[model samples]
Target: MAKKDYYQILGITKSAEEREIKKAYKKLAMKYHPDRNQGDKTAENKFKEIKEAYEILINEEKRTAYDQYGHAAFENGHSNNTYSTFTSSSDFSDIFGDVFGDIFGGNRTKRAKKGSDLCYKMEILLEEAVKGTKKEIHIPTLQKCKKCHGSGASIGTKPYSCSTCNSKGQIHIRKGFFTVQQSCPTCQGRGTIIKHPCNGCHGQGRVETYKTLLVKIPPGIDDNDRIRLNNEGEAGSNGAQSGDLYVQISVKKHPIFEREENNLYCEVPINFTMAALGGEIEVPTLDGRVKLKIPCETQSGKLFRIRGRGVRSMQNRNQGDLLCRVVVETPVNLNEQQKNLLHELGKSFNDFRGENNSPRSKRFFDGVKRFFDDLTR
Candidate 1:
């Protein structure tokens, strides 16, 4: 008799994905498995058909040949003769292992687990962030026991194989038609038990102790940046690999300067005479004091840019510019003689007339007059 179509046998379309094919096979295998069906001949035949269809379609090379030549690709002494034979119970067990491994913890191999990671927050001054510095931090963490060398066994003693799981670290429990594997209860999946525990750690293989670590802060590090120190976290159990430490940095506020990226900004107070008449004045920078030249007729809120006087770049060695905003200071608490001299100076400028000495104030008042006239109209 001619064989049935593979896609029709699996109840899937030719365009079905590999995962869909596996899913359909799993569903049918569960329903018609010989173990589930007992002595039913019809279910056994149907299970064989499903298994044969899955074997051909699951293999890329066989599926390609079957798609081109149909069932003839496996007939007449072809290398694909393996699909004609029904698989044994061992094959079903391998399939079950692949499908239910994660749910039942069926992995047989045992490996040591790494220690847990740790996080530490460090606060530093803005100056320290701008310039690199080293700091030592003290942390309380789990360290491997010195007396037992992380084995949890006392002197002249050792760990023995677990009796519950026979040192397999896992136990298999048969549930009807399926076998579920879980961690051994006695050893907690460690596969061994310490015969005599060390006095220091009491069978934990680690002890809580204070450790000092030195961390180097890189230059030009901004606030909220992080530095990772590998293998500096809690000690691992039973000679496993240690975890890592993360250091979070926070920069403090500066009194005189505000930093944005690589630039620094500050406001400088300038006398009214200096604004009216050009002069050189001293200003503060990160490096030291520097002379700033203010041109004649300089107004309040005028910004001055000084090259290479700002924060340095972390990636490259390039320096940034500094921005200084000038605010003209008004004279106050004048004596009688000073007031008389100021009055004489003000009279010389013809305050009542349209004098251009204070051009900004004159234009502002003229604009206000025009606004009022328009409102009346």
Candidate 2:
């Protein structure tokens, strides 16, 4: 049978853009790759077909010719056979270097790679988060070598232009009927070579050192917050731009409080007497101790909201509220006299049960009775 249409196999129209072509090719290649399919003959054939199709489509000139003349253009030798071109890995480096230069400022191929970014994780107390604080950190990183001043060469000498590429840092290779441009082997892709290397950094231009920086943690900053300091990263070779430093913030666990967004939650233990006869109590807050009133006959797990007592967000002026959950504490380690007094109190509340007793408990027991009665029926 005749071969399937290449465009149809890759699922694209002739008018597809470069990105679309690459996307389609990558999908098909991954699906039928020889390494993935192993002994599957059909998959192997499909892989080769797609590879050939992509090779033609990715090259503008060859793609145009294939579209106009079909496969006959290659058989008749009427078009340039760019698909048969063989390029060295170095050549690919130069092409990417030029492309990266246009996309990100300056040619990366011509300069030493920038140092990697560094992250410093810091833990701050809840009080510190409420009112911003500054901290100093020491980090080890690669800095520009002072001896050679980032040149990677002796003090009196500089790198010389590579002769292989005539300082262009690229070379054209011809294979079969095609030509592909790649980097020059002699100078890699930097176009220059060091004649006398620096002794301090061994020609790398950067050295390992420890650096100190002052990081400011903003107020209201929450856990896992990140702050970035630009150009504070490791030094780049040949005096290229340095990397960046990132400070990650983590809030230490509070002894008496839990944080959620801008809000604060705390559990306050109230004595049984306080729950029985409501009174004022002191609660701890970031600012200071604040007075909170407890109503008479208050029960455990009662939440009290304190407005404007939580956090003030860095971005907004509105402050958050503090939530206090009350837990009635039972008297513990009581003496004989205390036990007798409690027993008298219990006798006084003996008639507090049933309909006139705790109304909530009575209602809950009534619900349970109705539920079991329905189940039995």
Best by TM-score: 1
Write model 2 residue lDDT over 303-353, tens digit each, in one string: 999999998988876799899999999889999999999888767666444
For lDDT, the strongest prediction is 1
| Residue 323 CA displacement from its true place in model 2, Å | 1.5
Local accuracy of candidate 1 as per-residue lDDT tens digits, 104-188: 4457534256788999999998788887899999998998889998888898899999988788777776666676667888888
TM-score of 1: 0.75
Number of residue pairs clashing in candidate 1, backbone atoms closer than 3 angstroms, sequence gap of 3 or more or interchain: 0
Candidate 1 — which pairs collide? none
lDDT against the true structure, each candidate: 0.84, 0.79
RMSD of each: 5.3, 9.2
